[model samples]
Target: MDMSIVLQAGVATGTALLFATLGELLAERSGIMNLGVEGMMLLGAMAAYWVSAHYGVPWMGVIIGMLAAGLISQIHAFITINLRADQVVSGLSLNFLAAGVSVVLGEGLNSIKGVAILPSFTIPLLSQIPWIGKIFFTNQGILVYIGYLVFPLVWYFINRTRQGLHLRAVGEFPAAADSLGINVYRMRYLYVFIGGLFAGLAGAAISLSISPGWFSEKTTSGEGWIAVGLVIFAQWNPIRAAFGAYIFGALRRLVLDIQGPMMILGLANPFYYNPYFGFFLQMLPYAFTIIVLVLGSREAIKKRIGTPAALGIPYIRGERGM
Candidate 1:
């Protein structure tokens, strides 16, 4: 019942959503909404798990996973960006495609041949501190370190760089950006592909770090979709996404951590002790996602902003729709 353990696990669990939210934010920034995040994540998990089990190189799994997700994203890029298809439909299609393919590919691998987790590291002097070090630094994997490094760099690139401005401009007003000589299609493709890369890493975090092994079942659960919801609550900012992801992560772990107590309390109260109580608690994370989506949309409406202007809208060259 130690608080630190729960907090630590929550933060570690949140790392997957953190990478996912970051990637989605980047893609949305360029006005391309790649909803295939869940599918891409699944493929990445499968790829990483395969490498970890067979190649015996955990870090290599990260690299291969990213590449695999990146490649899968290109399909969406081609359909939506090149073929000018509906982004939502195209992205959703990839979800089914990814789910089926991952299972088929892993059919022969024995579940007993479990994968290994990435090695963990701690800061030299800082890790010796009291509660602070234990909560923030100790007993974390390399991906956590890499994830921490991503926030600042992403913040800088999106807010400070000239290219970042162009990307934003393309998302907000692709027509105007096109008039100003920016290739809207090119920017969209680039950002969407980059988003896939992050999604891939997110998947790797699950198999190679979070769960530390592979099972036959779908690994990500609904985490990818939850990450999609997190973007709105975060108002499309990487820093805010990190905070929201952590909050959601905490909720995810809290259900398990408190299950025994909740179940114990149920012993006295028929409602609390009912077998279905656990299911309700388990649903809390996804339920919160729906709340965020609803409330977040209203808040965005009040502020006159929530998403990129052209988000989920396919860009047809030289055509003005609005």
Candidate 2:
């Protein structure tokens, strides 16, 4: 394969995963575990493809796609945050719901097997960079650019802003934040909603850029789950999450580019099957997450690199319990 193709594939994958990971990082930092990312992504992809196909304006499709995914994710957030439902269960149910809805809706709209393919765009100056420039900028859709642009903004929002500090407080100790007059529930809702928006955008990127208007039952595959794992691997940092996504993207491209008799040798084949290699590569991010969690749990790492104190715990205003 040409180096340009490899670079393009890696950049595409990284851009797609980056949006998902960044969204998940935001949600997780707010003390919410959203497993419905896959579902939301699929819905977003379908919506984007459908709108783009029907209207002839790809940007509209992108907007609709993000809104659709964000809306679905908001349902999960509403139930889990306001209703005090089990966050994991709510997230899982949302995932299943989104997947089912996407399939049914796709069939209804297309009366065909799957979704339509999307178009690509090429910016002039940005696309003309060296090898890396072409891969990252040229021959890609606007969504890819948006994905890269969102990173620094996300970082600034999460680490440097007062709202970000409040968000962290809500995630770490809602009760403490509440005592300080912070609206814990409101903060959670806001972050969760924004997270959904990013997730939607991520899904749209896959549909619009990577798949390029193609949709299938396995549209998103397990990329959403990989994003969840990425959040853990990144320790809830957007900058770190981007790098983690790139690493995974490179691994994914490697699986795609490798060929010939090298398959028989374990050196070339990371898993038994080629397609399944994506799954194994996906697992790598999560495996790394476990390793980090374990290491972070140790006294040495804990003192220096600790998890958000109240992650996954429910916060009742007047209640005192773990």
lDDT (Cα, tens digit) per residue for candidate 1, span 1-322: 4667777778888999999999999999888888889888888888888888888888898999998998889889999988978988998998788767877886765464655669887777777888767766888888887887897789889999999899889888899899889988888888888999999899999888987665544588888899888988888888989988878877888777765443343355333456567788888998889988888888888988768888888777767672
Off by over 4 Å in 1: 110-114, 128-130, 260-276
For residues 178-230, what per-residue lDDT tens digits would candidate 2 score against the true structure? 99999887777777777787777887888767866545556787888888877
Q: Assess candidate 2 and give its TM-score to the true structure.
A: 0.83
- lDDT score at residue 178, model 2, on the 0-100 scale: 91
Q: Give TM per candidate.
A: 0.92, 0.83
Clash pairs detected, candidate 2: 116-213, 117-213, 117-214, 118-212, 118-213
**Candidate 2 global CA lDDT score:** 0.76
Collision count for each candidate, in order: 2, 5
RMSD of each: 2.5, 4.1
Q: Per-model C-alpha lDDT, please? A: 0.83, 0.76
By TM-score, the best candidate is 1
